[model samples]
Target: MTETVVANPFEQAQAGRPTGPLVQGFEVIIGFETHAQLSTESKIFSRASTAFGAEPNTQACAVDLALPGTLPVMNKGAVERAIKLGLALGSHIAPRSVFARKNYFYPDLPKGYQISQFEIPVVQGGTVSFFVGDELKSVRLVRAHLEEDAGKSLHENFIGQSGIDLNRAGTPLLEIVTEPDMRSTAEAVAYAKELHKIVTWIGICDGNMQEGSFRCDANVSVRRPGEPLGTRREIKNLNSFRFMQQAIDYEIRWQIGEIEDGRKIQQATVLFDPDTGETRAMRTKEDAADYRYFPDPDLPPLAIAQEWIDRVKAGMPELPRAMAERYVRDHGLSEYDAAQLTQSVALARYFDEAVSKGATPKLASNWITGEIARRLNAQEIGIEAAPVKASQLGQLIARISDGTIPNSAARVVFDALWSGEGSEVDAIIAAKDLKPMNDTGALEKIIDGVLATNQKNIDEYRAGKDKAFNALVGQVMKASQGKANPAQVNALLKAKLG
Candidate 1:
C-alpha cells in the first residue's frame, strides 16, 4: 500500500526548516557525548601505566589482564579528577554512585565486560554555554561519568592483520553527555571547541585530538517543529573539529534526503570516512540491554568529602569566559577584541602578564590580539614561545602611547624585537633615530619641505579637493622617512598648508 504524503506548502515549508536559529544556515539540533581521557598516571581500576607509547603490553598488569585472584581497585587520582572536572563545570557530585559491569565481548575487552558507570554517575546536572557569532547558545549537561578505556586495536601488517596495543587499555576517561540543544553544524563545532578549551583550561584533559584525549560522538536527526523527532543517526568517534563538521553535514543531508524519498532512517553505530567525507554504518546501534549493565561487586563505592570539592573548586584558575568578560569590563576592551585575546589560555595568561608589567590593557590587547597573534601564526610559534618578551613588548607599547617613539615607527621596533636581534625597544628606537618629532619647530621644517615638493597637490587642496591634503601628508611622511606621527602630520600639514 502506498501512503499519500500531504501536499500542504505551509507544512512542507516547515518540514524542510533547518534546526536552531536561521542565521546559522539551518537549525541543527546536536547533543554531544564527549569522552575526555583523564590525565592520570595509571588506569582507573588497575596499576597498569596509562602513559602513551610504551611497549604494547608493557603497561598491563595482572588486574588489567583479568588474571585470577585479582580484584579491581579504583584509582584515587581518577576519582579526584572527576570531582575536579565536575566542580569546574558546576555539576553536582552524586554522594554515592556505584560502578557497573558493562558486558561486551570484543578483542579489546580482557574480562569480556568493561567496568563503567551506568544508572548512577559521578556527576549530574551541569551546563556548558558556548558562543555562536555573538549569540550565546547553551547546551545543558545531562551527566558526566568516569569509566575505564578499552584497549586499542592496531591493524598493522602481520601478513594478514594488525596487533593490539593495550598500553591505552586501562586509561581513564570522563564521558560528558549533553542535552540535544545544538541546531547547526557550525554550532556543534563551536560547542566542541569551547568544551575543548574548558577541559584543557581546567587542566584535567589535554585536548589532544590526535591522541584521542578528546573525542565527541554527535547524534543528529531531522524533525518538523511540533512534530515527532525523526529516526536519529549516531555518528561516532569524530575526532577533529573539521571531521565533526563533515560528519554532521553529511549525516543531515543523508537524513533529509532519506525522509524525502520515503525511506525510514535506521538507528545504528556509524564511523566517518575521513578520506571520502561520508558516514558508514559500523553496527546496529547497541541499546542498554545489549550492554547488560550491572553493578560491579569487585569495587566498593568511591567517597568524596565537601572539603575536597571546596579545595578543588578553589584551585581552578579563571576560566576563558570569565576572563574575557573581565577584560572587557575592567580594561575597556571590546567584547570581540577580548574574546580573540582570551581564545587561548596561553595568550590570555600572557596578556595578564603584560598587564601586570604595566601595559595599558586596551593597547596590550590590541598588540597581542592583532600584531602578536598574526606574527606567531606566521612564525609557527605559540604565544608561550614568542621571541618578544612580555616586558619588552609592554615597553614598546608604552613608548608609543606615551610619545617616546613615533607610532608609525613602532612597527619597525616590533619587527626587530620579534626577530630576537634587538637589544631593548628603547635602545633600538634610539639607535635607529625613530623618536617622535613632537617639537613644533622640527615638524614645521618637514611641513615646509612637503609644501614646496607637492606644489600641484597644494593647489589641488585649495581647489576643493579634500583628498589632496592626504597626498601632502604622504610627502611629509616621506620627507621624515616614515618616522613622523601620522596624526601630528595630518594636523600640522593642514594648519601650515592653509
Candidate 2:
C-alpha cells in the first residue's frame, strides 16, 4: 500500500529490462482498469450519432462539445448497459449514485472536463474469476461507474502533436476497476479477456479492441513477500491483450532496474507502443485531489428501485460459465466439447436447438463446434448468418446417424449445403448413386467382381500380405465409385477371403 513516489526522474521510454530481476525470481504484481464502451446508438447525454465509420465531426453535437447553455440529457440505454455489466460481474447495484465532473483539460476533451462517477460509483464489491491453465484465479472489483468518454485524439503530425476528433466524444463508458490482486502479467491478461467476454456476451459492449470499444490499463509494482508495496505506474489505453501483457512485464522490470540501480521509482502515467513493445512516461499519476471531482448540478442522482434490479436479472440469459456447466451435466458432453459449444451465445443456442430437434447430443455438439463453426469461419460470417439452418443440419445429422449416409459422404453433403449449388443430401446420393453397400449380398457381388479382375491381389492376400488386402479394398471402392461403405466392404471381404 505504499503510494508515494521516491525521488527519480528516469525517462520511462528507455526500454529498460533487468535480466537479473527475473533470474532472481522477483515477482510482478498487477492490477487492471478495464473500460467498456456502452453499445448505445446515441451519445450518453446527447442525441448525436454514435455510429462507427461516420465522417469526423459529423456526429459532434454542441452538447458533446460542452457549448454554453446546452444541457445534457442522459441516455437510458447507457444506464441499462452499465447495470447489465454490473450484474454480470456480481456487483451490488447502488440504490442511488451521482454523476460527477472529472476536471481535466485536453484538446480531445471539448468540455475541458469529463462527466464521470468518482467516489460514489454506481456499482461495487464484485469478483471476477479467470483460469490460468487449470487453476481459477479471482480478482476483486473496487467499483464500476458510468462515465462519458472523451473525444479521440488523432495522431496525424508524424510529430508528437495529435489533432482532435470529436466524433467519439460523449460516448458512454463503464469503467470497471480491480483491486491489486494479480501477481503476474498472465493473471492480468486472463482477467481482462474474461471481462471482455462477459460484456460482449451480454450485448452490453461491442468489445472491439481495434476500434477502442474496449480499453485496458494495468498498474504494475513489485516488492519482497513481507515488504511494503512498491511504487506503481499506469500503462494507459492498452487496446489489445498482447500489449496488456507486454506492458506489465516491461514496466515491472523497468521499475526494478531503476530501484536496484539506486534510483527510486516515480508514480506516473505511461504509454505502451505495440510495435516496439515498450512504455513511455506520459505524466505524474493523478489522485482524486488532482481530478477535483464534484457532483454535476445539471443531472440528478440516479435512484434504482428493487423492481428494476429484479427486471434486469430476469431478462439476463444464461451466462457462458453456467451454460457450459449445464451442457456438461445435462447432455453428458465432455468438458472440452461443452466449452467449445458455449464459447459464443449464438453458437450455443444453435447447438441446443439442433439437439432438441432429435440430433444426438454428442453428435450435435460435435457438428456445431466443428463443421458448422468451420463453415462460419470460412465464410467470415457468424452463426446468425450461417447458410445451413439448424433444422437442416439436424436433419442431415439424423440421416448420417440412421446409416443413410456415411460420415465421409456427409461432409460432402455439408459442403454442398454450404456451397448452395449442390442438390439436397438424399437427391445427391441418389443422383450420384452414393447409397452405401451395407447389404453383404450387394457388396459381395462387387468384391467378387474386383477379385476376379485382380487374381494377383487375391493370391497376395491368401499369402498373408496386408498390402494386398488394401489394394483389393481400393479396387472394390473404385468400382463402386466410393458408394460402398468401407466398413461393410471390409466385413464382407473378411468373410469371403477366409
TM-score of each: 0.89, 0.76
Model 1 clash tally, residue pairs: 10
Give the distance in Å from residue 105's predicted Cα in candidate 2 to where it truly belongs: 2.0
**Per-residue lDDT of model 2, residues 85-196, tens digit only:** 7788888788788888999988999888899887667887688876776566788787888999988878876487777789999998998888777777777888898888
The lDDT for every candidate, in the order shown, is 0.80, 0.80
lDDT of 1: 0.80
Query: In model 1, what are the clashing residue pairs, if there are any?
Result: 18-27, 19-27, 19-28, 20-27, 27-183, 28-183, 28-184, 29-183, 30-182, 156-162
